[model samples]
Target chain A: MRLKDRVAIVVGAGQSPGEGMGNGRATALTFAREGAKVLCVDHNLKSAQETVEMIGANQGTAMAFKADVTKEAEIKAMVADAHSRWGRIDILHNNVGVSLSGGDAELLEITEEAFDRCVAINLKSCILAAKHVIPIMRAQKSGAIINISSMAVITTYPYVAYKATKAAMVSFTEQLAYQNAAYGIRANVILPGLMNTPMAVDTRARTFKKTRAEVEAERDAKVPLGKKMGTGWDVANAALFLASDEASFITGVTLPVDGGASVRRG
Target chain B: MTRLAGKTALITGASSGIGRAIATRFLAEGATLLLMDITEAVVEGGEPTHKILDVPFFQGDVSNEKDVDEAVRRAALPTGRLDIVVNDAVIRIGKKLTDTSLEEWNRVMAVNLAGVFLMCRAAVRQMLTQEIRHEARGRIVNISSQHGMISSPEDVSYGTSKAGVVYLTRQIAADYGRDSIICNAVAPGKILTGKTGRAVEPRWLDYSHARTPLPRLGRSEDVANAALFLASDEATFITGENLMVDGGWMAG
Candidate 1:
């Protein structure tokens, strides 16, 4: 009810086969449940379709759009298509991300292609999407943009490119808030910590050389409260609040949804 | 069942405003309420134990060791367990550094910052002494302000004290997370409550609404909803975080 009649676009909403959901998919469903017409966008058509089908099954209005967010032309087309279908975009959830295998590498070990790819997908996509959507939002004089960040930026996650891009995203959100406040456009970031989801599991297993169970157990032990990792729904719920009118007075801030993980050692 | 059914909670500054709102919400959520206020009016609304709820009121200065100790002792007597502790009592001393008196600064810091420390010390000791349950653990929610994270040119003492609460929350979380205790802070911005009037000075309200992207001030209930989340099992992985329930004011 909080977001009644709002049109939301959740980018990177592809579903991974596993127990927990991804941030994009969860956010898409959450927005739909709260009465927002959602457009579930992802690189994989099948994954986007899955989220769309779930919303449809629940009698919520939704559609699936597949596009590579890293490409400007694709992003522009995506926004235009959304406008054509929904008439307006009231909320944009920039949830695209990828965990690359460049952790703790020396400057020499870092490849140009990897760094470029990381910046494009993880950070530039947000800028490009905002660039395309800003005019639409300005015309309407109201909109909310929720960007997903990682606690690794604050903690000891030694992925140089990842950390730099995520940190820049925070600054991006702040600048966006200041520039667009006049038009009633709000921008904020959500920094998730040690989440136990399919994306996390796959990333840990592939990058950290740990089995699924080991990665989960390791994550749980590091968390101080409940001694466990959070779910995608947790991040989704936080995003829901931030994107909804409930957070109408909130902008230019970063909300940490980690279960007390950042404060564990500080 | 209540979100906090069968649990005992101790709330400081329970007499009015945000503290009172939290206490009322806790009661509605089924927590056995232990109310504390510097003034005797905290218990003035009614006698302790109204209907089936055990509502105990304690009058004490949070900064005084004896008062805090006595409040803790009384709260622990009934259930022999303290499940939740909220440090929400703070006095608003709206003044710049040059205008603030030493006495006023000391008094505000004593109650706003030191008082929270004393209460947490007592609550953590009690939580460690009790038998641990499987699903349920101890919770501590500190009421900070958006001023803690950002600037508040009008109120130096209040802002500094709230910033201290942020650090204190993190310190407590680091020290006790190993013991199954969680600590967090809620920072609210420009909230309208009983203490606030709808007729805000036109210029200030206009500036605030304009600066806030949402184009409005916050309500106390907005903060209470966030507190409910942090105090519930849903926030089990959360600790040492300062959740700003401000309507995007800090975001700007």
Candidate 2:
């Protein structure tokens, strides 16, 4: 009941088309389980509705809203919808990101179109949503903004767009924290490393033409702890911490939920 | 459910300040506790933490390896398992490099760096024997300072020792992750831990406020909150991290 009665807008609160849970859906469910009234927003309306249904099944308060977050008009409408429903938005979780599914690739091979799409989804969406929500938060004098980045920002990654956009999000979060501290608003970012989410493993398996076991084994080998890939619950737990009053004094921090991989930064 | 229900936690430097704050937070979350410090005297002139909480208090300096080992041994006696260890004993010699004498420098290193190393070694040794729970055999939270990453005003030796603490935390995390022993550090910046004297002096306070980006300075509870998060089950996947509960000081 950490987030009891709090109004939360979880953008990208939909699972990818595959096996395990995605980070966004896991975070939305975690928030709901802790008593947050979550607005599950996703480009895919049905997927967002599915997340809402899961929360409903658990007797949690939540709703699904459809919006391609990259569009400013839709982002504004989504924020307004939540504010009109709840009167105040206490938490804003920006959890959208893409790599292979968004056609991200090595520098020379990536197209401008794919790069722009990743930037829009991963980076700009966060900024635009914050732009719309900050005023409401400022009026209320309190809010918590949890942005999901990746361990790739610090650790080496083959793709360019995700690395660059995720890194920028970190800087943006810091700026948001310092600038808005006077209003009692806190902003922080979580960098998840090789999570065993549908988007992370299933997409890799599909792209590489490998078995799920093969991809899981390869990713598990990269993790230092338990030699196992972390589940969506790990990232979800972190989001819950950052969103709750337990982290009241924490702001502008980059927490890596990467076991110990980021520790080996050479 | 309580976050730390039925867990056993041992915290050093628990008489006052950040360590004392951590003790109460852990206790409130259902942890069985053993507190260790050089003396039971509260620095901020309040009742002793162990007496108030009715927990066992072992009085010994962390710089002494025998004391550290004995404390670890006794901490596990309560539940036959040491689930969490917080290395927070520190001695600060706030002098410029040129002004610090050899004796002062050695003393800071002894209680800061060597003390953390000994406590970590002892805790890890005892933890290696325990079975894993909540994806971890044990968790170690080292209280490092933000000064170690950036400059610590006039303090040189103290900052160097804290830098060692950060490095030591990473080393333990990297080497022991396979053993399911989670290790992390909480770096606090300008925390006003209800202490008076030089820390709250106008000149130092001004410097702290200038560097800190938050609307207000930090409290001991601020550091405690971050420490509790790292020590609990919520942070199972997080290791080798130096989490800054600085209110954006380092980020600034």
Provide DockQ values for all models, in the order shown: 0.44, 0.81
What is the docking quality class of candidate 2?
high
Q: Write the per-residue lDDT of candidate 1 for residues A1-266, one digit (tens) a residue.
A: 76899998899888665666887888898899989998889988999999999999999999899899999999999899889998999999999877563233435677788888888888989999999999999999999999998887677775678778888899999888878877888888989988888887767686778788988898888876667788888888888878876566667878787776777544
Cand. 1 TM to true fold? 0.85
Model 1 chain A worst lDDT run, 10 consecutive residues: A99-108
TM-score of chain B of each: 0.90, 0.99
lDDT of 1: 0.81
Q: Flag clash pairs in model 2.
A: none
Summing lDDT over every window of 10 consecutive residues in candidate 2 chain A, give the lowest-scoring window: A257-266
Candidate 2 per-residue C-alpha lDDT over A1-266 given as tens digits, one digit per residue, 9 for 90 to 100: 89999999999899888898888999999999999999999999999999999999999999999999899999999999999999999999999989889989999999999999999999999999999999999999999999999999999999999999999999999999999987999999999998899999999999999999999999988888878889888999999989998778789999999989898764
Give the winner by TM-score: 2
lDDT of 1 by residue, B1-252 (tens): 376887888888877666777777789988887888877453225433222244778888899988998888888888898888999888868889999999999999999999999999988988888776644458899999878678775889989999999999999987787787888898988776645343266665786677565556777677776777677665666678888776666765
Candidate 2: Cα lDDT at B204: 97
Candidate 2 Cα misplacement greater than 4 A, ranges? none
C-alpha lDDT (0 to 100) for residue B87 of candidate 2: 89
